[model samples]
Target: MEGSAVRHFTPFWFSVEPVDTLAVRGAPALLNCSAHSDTPARVDWKKDGTFLNLASDDRRQLLPDGSLLITSVVHSKHNKPDEGVYQCEASIESLGTISSRTARLTVADGDGGSPGGWLRAVPLAIGRAPALHLCTPASVEGSHAVERWLFSH
Candidate 1:
């Protein structure tokens, strides 16, 4: 066995974990997740501690890079399906599964009682000078457009 090449297997690990995100109702949202390992890994997702079946859900898509994409955020007084805590799980046949940090998705209602309206402002603090946080949609197409503004009064 002289001059034989030895292969070192790297343990599976998450390189990019999903982060908390806020999406306007009827807009798309994405939860990023990336993993690395010596063996090919399969990716799955969980919502509210329950396994999410992306195959049955038409509005949801699992990207090739292990990211979950919501075609449209669904939120209403009667039904809010897209807003929940989510986690990404990666697994290999020979290795145990590894889970990423939990990320929460929040759906915000549109202003003026509209569903697709993209302008909203939240007051962070109220004092002699109030701080306002505003999120507006950008003019980009096919991309998640979010513009934030901080105003100190």
Candidate 2:
């Protein structure tokens, strides 16, 4: 076995998976996805169980890092296009393909009302000084991350 060389192979896997996100109407949204493999893997996206063609849609862009960026979310009473379940797929030649967890993109109105309703804040007294901290009001159901993103935009 002297001077012999051996090669190890690594299969395709997702390092960063997309998560459920709440996007505001007419605001930018991002679905994070990252994959790795011994060979170069091409990343694609699926929306509502159908293959998404990023080129056909001008509003959608696939970032260099494999993340999908939606320039503007479209949602209305009669027409809703961006609200659906999404999944990222990574594939390498001769290695087949692997899919990430399904993440849902919910579109909310731009009126500051989320699926979780309005966010409330309460004053906490700390040694005679009151500090305002964000607290989920009753009937609120969503992550702080989503809430922060919603308000930030």
In order, the Cα lDDT scores of the candidates are 0.77, 0.73
Alpha-carbon RMSD, each predicted model:
10.2, 9.9
Q: Relative to the unseen true structure, what is the C-alpha lDDT of residue 84 in candidate 1, on a scale of 0 to 100?
A: 96
Off by over 4 Å in 2: 1-8, 112-153
TM-score against native, each model: 0.70, 0.70
How many backbone collisions does model 1 have? 0
- Over 1-153, each residue of candidate 2 has an lDDT whose tens digit, in order, gives 789866567677998888887666777778888898878889999999998999899999998778898987888998888999999999887778999999998776755464445422222333322122222345345744423312221
- For candidate 1, the TM-score is 0.70
Clashing pairs in 1: none
What lDDT would candidate 1 get against the real structure? 0.77
